[model samples]
Target: MTVTWAGANARRLARQHLHPDAAATASPFAAPGDAVAAMLGAHAQVLSAAELSVGLRGDGLTRTDVRTALWTDRTLVKTFGPRGTVHLLPAADLPLWTGALSAVPTGPNPFPGNARMTPDQVEEVVAAVGDALTGAELTIDELSDEVVARTGPWAGDLVMPGFQAMWPRWRQVLHLAGHRGALAYAPNRGRKATYTNPGCTPLPGTGALPALIGRYLYAYGPATPAHFARWLAAPKRWAAEQFAAQAASGAIEEVAFGEAGPAWVVAGDTDVPDAPLRGVRLLPYFDAFAIASAPRERLFPGAAWERALGGGQAGNFPVLLVDGVVAGVWHQRRSGRRIAVTVEPLKPLSGARLRDLEEQVERVAAIMEGTAELTVGPVTVGPHA
Candidate 1:
């Protein structure tokens, strides 16, 4: 069956719990942990972004609540997850994430010349990382020292053309350690962060890939093997093999998405209700809903494609959604107790939509623990715009 774009949008809104009426449901998430689980995970390249993403879903949740889950309660973990980017996942799900991610072969090291470590050296660094963080939280410098001591002095050699100054060769293994469940970001120590083991023992089996793919489809379908591969940063062939196996087992089925052609969804998910999309959300940067959806042209549409996405890079800026579709881009700036939120809409909004946007601005400010002052009009997008 061919699902119209609007039909898909409606289904997506319901699945994402973005429809306004979903807030009143009996099982509405009461905490950040519940929200994270419902969404599969929250993109967490920025901690504040993840907090806002959770707060947007859960009624009465706050940044402090998210912090409590991540730090005090330890119900959530910050680690390199889908797409090899930092994400906030429910701590209990670490085994599934680690098992699935560990199976994907590592891509070529980006660092050039002596900066690049051989596969054996990389494995040694990964092992050293596990040793360094076992039962202890250590800052990057401390972890680097431990790696150099365990692996050799070469692990500490500086590699130029790094993200910020020259980074140590050992740094390359950090994400791999997280993917392998041997490392996770610890609560901040003063102004710096540390790393620790997630403490989840992997399940003794190979069901992880199928389980993960199933969860992904449930949350982010109708997607293709290519989409899954891109989302997981796995090899296309590996994703295709997994998809084929799942399909053979009747775990997934194919359907046509309007204009986007064939896609796959978890079996039995083809009967989604056509819920009306009725809400405005100030989705923070790297919000999972926007990033997970493919056929960006349909999701963003027209000028919004350029305005909201900004050169096709997802997560560069927060987005403004009207009735589950990208309508604008927004930014927030703080000055004392007030946050100035500037929204640039690709098209004029209805009075009701404008009020919804205002309410969303208030929500954003509340997440920041400050009063909100909104400006709707021509605003330039920039690093701090």
Candidate 2:
């Protein structure tokens, strides 16, 4: 059956708690891990933004609460997730994530031979990293020393070009180590980040992709293999093949997605919301909501397509969501105990929507442990870190 974009996005918003009723009535995610899982994963390239990404979706969660779940409770593991980006994923889902991510087809090494490690050398470094991180967290430099000692000088050869210097060849496999269940991020030491092994066993990769596909469809369904491919940075052909196989097994079913054409949803997840989701939200940079939603034309419609996006890429700037779709861009600057939130709306908003925007600003400020001053004007700042 064909589903309208409004119907599809409504359900997607409800699943991710991006709607007003869902965000207000849904039981607050029992823990930060639960929130991370619901969003698939929270992008953590900018840790503060990641915290807000998770915090806002759940009821009354502050940045400190999110940090506690990460550092103290250990319920969330900071690791490489979809698209090989830093993300906060649920610790309980590590086995599934590791199994699934490790099976993803990666392109050939882009680095020069001097900077790339052979398959066997990559394995050796992954094993060494696992050994070094077991039961102890080590900063990057410390881990470098440990890896070199355990592997060899070849492992530490500074051949890969970095910001201003050469990087060790072994660093290329850092994310691979995470996918192999051998590494995860630990609490930072001052300004230096650390890594540790979560000590969890990874399930076999054999049947993980189909299961991951189901999870993806549940959260962002009425989607296509192309959408899945874009979300994971996996090859589109591979994604299509997987979808075909899954469909053959009756694991997923096709549906007409209005003008977007046919899409897939988990076999039993064909129900759509009765009405479009309504709400105002302030989404942080790289928020999973903005990153994973597909048929980008719809999620970022009209002016948002050009303004909120960066050369067609999503998540470069913070987003202002009205009715589960990107309506504007936002920027936050903190000064002492106050936060200045500036929103640049692409379209004119109603007086009631403006009030809703103000309330959202207050909510964002509360989550950040500060007061917010909202300004609905041109946001001068550009893409954030």
Best by TM-score: 2
Clash totals, every prediction: 0, 0
Give me the runs in candidate 2 sitting further than 4 Å from their true place.
23-25
Global lDDT of each candidate: 0.82, 0.89
Per-model C-alpha RMSD: 1.9, 1.3
Task: Count residue pairs with overlapping backbones in model 2.
Answer: 0
lDDT of 2 by residue, 177-196 (tens): 99988999998899899999
Candidate closest to the true structure, highest lDDT: 2
Cα lDDT of model 2 overall?
Answer: 0.89
User: Compared with the true structure, what per-residue lDDT tens digits does model 1 show for residues 1-385?
Assistant: 7666676666665666676666564355787887887777898877888998998877778889999999999899999988778999998888988888888866665767878888899789888888888899999889889889998989888874567688888887778888888899998899998999777665533688888889888877888898888777778887888899899999999899777789889998886557666778788888888887776677788787777776776667788888778888888877897888999887898999899888888888887778999999876866324
